[model samples]
Target: MIDGAAKSRKAQVHRMRRIFLFTLLSTFAISAQNKEKPTVQATPAPYEWPAEKDKKYQISSTFGESRIDHFHNGIDLPGEGSKVLAPKDGRVLYRINSEFTPGEMPYGGGNTLILDHGDGSNATWSGYMHLKTFADAVIKNAPIAKGEKLGTSGNTGHSGGPHLHFFIYHPGERAMLNPLLFLNDLYYRDTKPPEAKEWGVLLADKFANVNPDKPFRLSADYPVYIFLQDHGVGKERWGVFEYKVRLDEKEVISTKFDRIFFKEGAWSLATGHKFEDIFYRNLYALTPQVRRAKKVSVEAKDLKGNAFSKTFELKIQQN
Candidate 1:
């Protein structure tokens, strides 16, 4: 078995070329290489989950979710049959099967496929990666129907188990759109809201939890963080969809996670908020670090339109 360190390096070396080629095609636009003129979807969107809906499954991740350094570009769906299917009617633009390759699939995105669901200049590519094998029907530039099996899910890359990493890419927008925004037609829904537990202040480059009811000594303006938690249909924590912070009755920060922008080799939200600016030490979703404040309040919402809020009363603590 490959150890942790080896597993990482294995991915870097084996999948570098594959990733580059995939990015190249996706970057320019997968529709460019279509064998025939790309067709448009009859409906609004293929929005169907990338796997067998009737099969036992769970969404392990959400769109625009946070990662170590970059944000999650797509949703993670893990389920039975390993049946990877087409989210909508589209032409198979490309396919990759790492099993035929000699080394581990790098970038942890193994055995992938790209499908163009719209005509050129209006193309939206559905990404299905890390599959066990490609379905016979997933032919290059061949038309595929919604829910049609494209491949079997597999631990093709540096994966721990079998699951599917599905994503949506719009070439025109040059942004990663949130898959959940258009997937409300599904039988499953997430009504759970975000939970805000404790409030903390980031002072002197350190995070310290504090009770809103008690007095906290403060010298100057410092970043404040809130320990917030959110979940989907499952128990796994999902990031909030949007957030707004208020200080002394003035709106300080308002941001949403509807989409992610990749610019200058970095990930950011709307208004150019970096990962660190939005998340404090990767523990808090919003860091209200504006300035000296006597009152502060926070409001947040999850992807399902669930809302949550909390207000704090700060009494200046003297040293």
Candidate 2:
């Protein structure tokens, strides 16, 4: 009887040990998974430029601003009044009819359609702003194919002549994502480095006591956008004045503009991977704590080596 009791105790201890080990492993696994899931949809899906060959257009402004007070909420594809197409396989969320009398600066974004991809991710919209009308088959809750015609481009909304203002949005957060990364043939890159428009100590936008002479270390959590204003038109050098972005004067990002063929006026632009909203938290290891009330300076230079500097102060906080 004593032997049996001892044996039973031993088995119970062994089972308990196994259970404890399993729970420990499970906890560790869950932690690893949490660290691995990306904040943004890094996975490239089947997305093509939403325009046909004869589509007369160019991409204008992009997501994230080099300036303050306004951040681009979406990618702007210059439609020069071309028929806009669906970005990918998705459902129409809504179609908004618009009026053009607002005197909005760049027109053609009127008569827009929103698309829901059902992935907690949706294109808040896609449409030929200032369009003549929807395609014959287009209707609310209708399915759209990639590159299918939705409407004929027209001069509507706030516009500069006839052009389509193509845009893409992260529906939930309403953040504008660079549509170029999602599109296959709709980008420009060149081997030559972009012209150096300027380089300076980047600071938080809201610095009331901005010290331009001081090399303020960028707040470790804040990512900086190097705004180049001198990107020229059709200069083969991406018409870009050129630029270099450095953290502590160490080159982290730099580029030369690749000049496009027709839209010499079209600007070539790019951003630092470390500076995106989705990755700002990850950048904490790289910068200083930029207080909300601070300003960063840029020492910009033109093609002729003419140098000018500007300071932009903005309102930022640790969210």
What TM-score fits each model?
0.79, 0.49
Candidate 2 local lDDT, residue 94? 60
Which candidate has the highest TM-score of all?
1
lDDT of 1 at 206: 65
Q: What is the lDDT of residue 105 in candidate 2?
A: 24
Local distance difference test scores for all models: 0.67, 0.42
Per-candidate clash tally: 2, 39
Model 2 CA deviation exceeding 4 Å by range: 1-38, 42-44, 55-57, 66-68, 100-108, 119-132, 172-174, 186-192, 198-319
Clashes of 2: 39
lDDT of 2: 0.42
Q: In lDDT terms, how accurate is model 1?
A: 0.67
Q: Please state the error at residue 78 of candidate 1 in Å.
A: 1.8
Model 1, position 68, has a per-residue lDDT of 35
> What 10-residue stretch in candidate 2 is worst by lDDT?
257-266
Pairs that clash in candidate 1: 15-106, 110-130
